[model samples]
Target: MTGMSRCPAHTERAQTSLPALGIALVLLTVVTGLGVSMADAAIAGAERTPDERRVAAAIADRLVSADGPLAARSNVLNRSRVDDFDQSALERSAPPATEYAVSVEVADTEIASSGAVHSGTQITRLVVVEARESRTLTPDLTTTDTVTLPRRSAQATVTIDPPAGTTIWTVRANDRVVLHNRSGLDGSYEVPLIPYETTELRFQRAGSIQPGNVTVSYDAPRSTKESLVVTVDA
Candidate 1:
């Protein structure tokens, strides 16, 4: 028996379908390429999250350190320097990677920023800021009978030893009377120091009493502590 011959019209239809098959293959390749690109972007974004967090933590730690550029003491920031901080300071303090943006906030208030911050990682730190004036008074009372304070102190604590058969009459700071008592006194007393150019403290006594073991103490202005937040975008 003779083998069945192929139909001429059917062969032409099969040949024409080859171009459609090729077009379908091209479309599949393009779709696959696009999907791969999207996947890579998502993976990169996920990887950057941890890296940005680490960078932000490191930067915040450095800023709050005693030896860092913006710190006066450990976890204490200089208010003037913090106010002056800007993009240039951020760049100088940050790592040498230019792919990230950084911003700083103290007590929920934005202080410094660099680059656009749409989305990224964040870190918060406890920091102290000395925005007010601070001073310490430790007079040279060891060598002298009287103590003088260099600055005008608002408050002072005086410690003294009363001599036998003597009564403490009055206390004077910078020649201005501050405390006066008729009874015999011994131990510590808190007194408000008068604001003067030179504040001097002396005890007035009766019955030939000599001052012994006297100390005057003054505390500096108080500092405030708050949260410091750092954000980084990659």
Candidate 2:
């Protein structure tokens, strides 16, 4: 009878232990599922960084391209347009897929920007800014028969100060007749330079004024290096 009682007690203990084992297995499964989910999230977050970086780089490239909104030529920005840039223009120029921000700097001066910048992938691109430059040209006719422009010019202000008796007749640029006055010429004349080639201005039939003075003013397209930063947030 004592042995029979012990067997029944053992069975009861086994049944109680089975529930505990089942509970422990359920807890283990829950913990494992949580760990897998956390790992997947981490991996997804890591992959997003490269995507943001690529997007930022592509946007920057487009901004500095020849056909880009801010560019006058390939990788060259128009200084006047850049100065006029605002957030609205920037957004219109660069439409981001996700949240993003952009800032442009020329010669260490922050020129334009868009959106709010925070922690994000950034891309830096080299850009050139075309700034208008002015210079004065003085012709030394006494030294030489022809005066050659140092650089390509689009316009000039010609002032003829001839001697008492002599009068200017014609002006030729690179053998092409730009100005022709059969009677006589004096005073200031605005001349347009040839677009295709370099201009060599030659004065014909000037009086005692051995050295004639001509002022050629033009827009000189100058370029400088700048940094364009584009940042994208995911």
Candidate 3:
């Protein structure tokens, strides 16, 4: 060794005192923990702006209301409408959506968002989503010319397959003329009806008809409960 180099043990001891190193590391850990705790406390104490919370609540209320675009009844959302809901739909349904950053979700799936949201207020409401499912019914028209539907539907698919001698001239839904063919109605047709009341289809025919001659297919609404969440950032 040209310059009296220190041994490994001596070099290690000279680099730093064991007691001092231990104390420094312990103090560093304590300071870091304190800093983290203080940051958590500050964040917990910070609440969203009152206006943000109010707007969030309002948007949530409007989305679940009966007259809302996404809803079919009070707190009952239409699945078709919900699927079509977007930022434009949100702004149209709730005017406040245009002024603030708003996002709406159901069952954790985001349906509509107006703007970017980092952090703000959230309002949650319980709601039911109604989906229109196809259901078919073939009424027993062997003896009676009238048939009542079991469920209410907005429109029905009326399929006519009459025998050679039979001819259906007209069809009515509770006195409302749905189909009229002076020559003879011989094919399938879609008929619109009022969904608010029970429907009874009456057929006007000139020849004999039996069961399995007429069939009806309609969409019945099925509902499932879900949570509607609205978040607003201002």
Please give, for residues 169-227, the per-residue lDDT of candidate 2 as tens digits.
Answer: 89888878877898777778888886446778887875544544445555665767777
| Predictions: Cα RMSD each | 11.4, 6.5, 8.4
Highest lDDT scorer: 3
Considering every candidate listed, which one attains the maximal TM-score? 2
- Pairs that collide, model 2: none
lDDT of each: 0.75, 0.73, 0.87
Candidate 3: worst 10 consecutive residues by lDDT? 41-50
Q: For each candidate, give its TM-score against the true structure.
A: 0.49, 0.67, 0.66
6 Cα displacement, candidate 2 (Å):
28
Which residues of candidate 3, in runs, are more than 4 Å off? 1-47, 65-67, 87-101, 114-119
Decide which is better by lDDT, 2 or 3: 3
Tens digits of lDDT, candidate 3, 48-86: 477888999988988888898888888988998999999
lDDT of 3: 0.87
lDDT (10s digit) by residue, model 1, range 131-223: 545443444433444567654456788776665776666788866787777785678888786544657787666655343445567744446
